[model samples]
Target: MLRKHIPITVSHELVHFKQSPLKKEHTLLSTSIREGAAEFIAGLISAETDGTLAEFKGKEITRLL
Candidate 1:
């Protein structure tokens, strides 16, 4: 399963990279929100080899991307 969907993972990491600011302090809620937003954006832009992954991802994110 991991052997596939590398694009989604890359997209996810890229979102994190887009956060140019290196904050010294932030609340847990803020950090969680950041993570969640990254995930949501990545999912929107990520691709699927077939419909299978699209369906699977809709249910749950197995891993990165």
Candidate 2:
């Protein structure tokens, strides 16, 4: 589980990095938006690649939502 999560987490952070330059505040709102978008993308990728969105479920995803 933890192993599977690493890639998704890293991908999310990477998305934030790509978006960071355009973001102004980097405040809670910005952070949540960046992270949420990343997580959604990562979930999509995971579902496409791994054939399951199960990794995107549970506590972490719930918290993001």
Candidate 3:
């Protein structure tokens, strides 16, 4: 299952990279919080950029309660 998530993980990391430069504190965020936010934004980016978030819908269960 994890093997199938490489693209989603990369997308989330890309989102984090885009946010890193604008965050003022450079403080560390918990993995859950950081990954949750990245996943959410990346989902939106996927929907907009690729016309669907289906590839990442399953990953949401990990980040959302």
Candidate 4:
């Protein structure tokens, strides 16, 4: 079970790692963007629809961003 999700987990953490060095300070918006980018990148790489996370790949958040 855990192993199956490792790819997604690793991708998420990789995004964080890539962004970590550039950030000067942590803030709510920056954290949200980091987390959101992880999910978005993972989804793109996987190319499979995960019902649990599908709700996020929508227009609502896109408009806000």
Using TM-score, give the best candidate's number: 1
lDDT of each: 0.72, 0.65, 0.64, 0.69
Per residue, candidate 1 scores C-alpha lDDT tens digits across 18-39 of 9766478888988888877777
Tens-digit lDDT track of model 3 for 1-65: 35556666678778888764545654456555776788787677664231256877767655645
Say what the RMSD of model 4 is: 4.8
Per-residue CA lDDT of model 2 for 11-45, tens digit only, reads 66677777747546468887667666877887776
Q: Candidate 1 at 27: error in angstroms?
A: 1.3
**C-alpha positional error of residue 45 in candidate 1 after TM-score superposition, expressed in Å:** 0.6
Full-model lDDT, candidate 4: 0.69
Question: Which is the better candidate, 1 or 3, if ranked by TM-score?
Answer: 1
Q: Candidate 3 at residue 58, lDDT?
A: 64
> Across residues 1-65, which tens digit of lDDT does each residue of candidate 4 receive?
45677777777677778875546777899777777877888778776322274656664553543
> Model 2, poorest ten-residue lDDT window?
44-53
Prediction 4 TM-score vs. true: 0.58
Which sections of candidate 2 miss by over 4 Å?
Answer: 22-27, 48-65
Q: On lDDT, who's better, 2 or 3? A: 2
In Å, residue 32's CA in model 2 sits off its true spot by 1.9
Ranking by lDDT: 1, 4, 2, 3
State every prediction's TM-score relative to the real structure: 0.61, 0.51, 0.41, 0.58
lDDT of 3: 0.64
Runs with alpha carbons beyond 4 Å of true place in candidate 4: 22-25, 48-65
Backbone clash count, each prediction separately:
2, 0, 0, 0
